[model samples]
Target: MGLLLLLPIVFVSNALVPTQRMTPWLRDLTTWNPISAVTAAARELLGNPNPAASIDAWPMQHPVHATPIWSSDY
Candidate 1:
């Protein structure tokens, strides 16, 4: 049930649409999204090209550091 609810959120998050392409408000939303932080951290760890590279958001820039903070909040 939780997974179902979160599925649409994943599409709305930076996972599907690159942060750079979203509106400023949307980009900010995705920037603070825990999923985005996790995805960014994972991409960083896996050596994959980050889709949020073009955005100058702090979370995208320091995903490794953001991951711990994001996790603690949940």
Candidate 2:
């Protein structure tokens, strides 16, 4: 669809453009739709240096069943 093609265009254009001028449009785009175009832009900007790398190697807190206890549950 035409709209699908626009997503990548919007993402690349926003990423290549100066942040100042692009900020408004980027913000509006992200707020208007959390997925697709806006999401792509965000990933291009904030994603790790090696975007191709898998997230399994990334540092993150462990097992879902394990919860840290700072104090007694009471």
Candidate 3:
């Protein structure tokens, strides 16, 4: 059940597939997804190749700052 639920979010994130091809609404979701923020933060902190997003959404744009926000129970 958990895997099934998580699968959709994982698939929709910028993790596996590039979000560039998605529709605007979906792209928005991808940008706001905590998974995306985490991924970006990880890539950035690890000095990996993080792709530049044209969207400029807060999470993707500022993942290092966004991760703690997403991790908190608000």
Candidate 4:
């Protein structure tokens, strides 16, 4: 059951693959996912290579700011 919940979030996000190659609807879904924000945030902070996203999704574009907001109590 754990895999059921966790797998979709991981696979659906950009952590495993770049969002540019995904379908438009799927890309949108992946871009807005919190997992993607977290991964993007990690890349930004750790100086990892982040491939340029073709679409300008707010979460992906500003993950450093998005991560905290997604995790916040408010």
Candidate 5:
């Protein structure tokens, strides 16, 4: 579920932002926005504070590093 939110952000950041003309605020959103939908869904499904188990391999460079919140520990 968390991966779902990350998907769009990652797509926009890596694909759209480079070629498109977006405002600074919009660019900021693209960079920092959290995937609320995915987070909520994960919370519902996992019933835990941590949603790391819900992430998959595609969007994450290293699936093992993917967590509910961004972490440099990865």
Candidate 6:
């Protein structure tokens, strides 16, 4: 039941469609998705390839700062 509920969240968190490729509304959703923040933080820490890093979004531009902000919020 919990997994079912969480499935859509996972899908919308930019795993399926890169935020850059999503429609504007979806892109906005993905931008603030906690998963995106976590992923961005991980990529920054691990030096992994993050395709979205090139985008001009605040989270993408300052992932290290965004992660803590997101974490404290929820």
Ranking by lDDT: 4, 3, 1, 6, 5, 2
Cα lDDT tens digits for candidate 3, 1-74: 99999889888788877777899999888989988888888988999877734557878778999999999997
Question: Where is model 1 more than 4 Å wrong at Cα?
Answer: none
lDDT of candidates 1 onward, in order: 0.82, 0.34, 0.84, 0.84, 0.41, 0.79
lDDT of 6 by residue, 1-74 (tens): 99998788788785556677678888888887877877877877898878778778898778888878877945
Q: TM-score of each candidate?
A: 0.80, 0.21, 0.84, 0.84, 0.30, 0.76
Instruction: Decide which is better by TM-score, 2 or 6.
Output: 6
How many Å off is the CA of 73 in candidate 2? Answer: 45
As for candidate 5, its clashing pairs are none
Clashing pairs in 6: none
Q: How big is the positional error of residue 68 in model 4, measured in Å on the Cα after superposition?
A: 1.1
Model number with the top lDDT: 4
Query: Ten-residue segment with the worst summed lDDT in candidate 5?
Result: 57-66
Error of 6 at 14 (Å): 2.4
Off by over 4 Å in 3: none
Reference-based TM-score, model 2: 0.21
Quote model 1's TM-score.
Answer: 0.80
Clashes of 2: 0
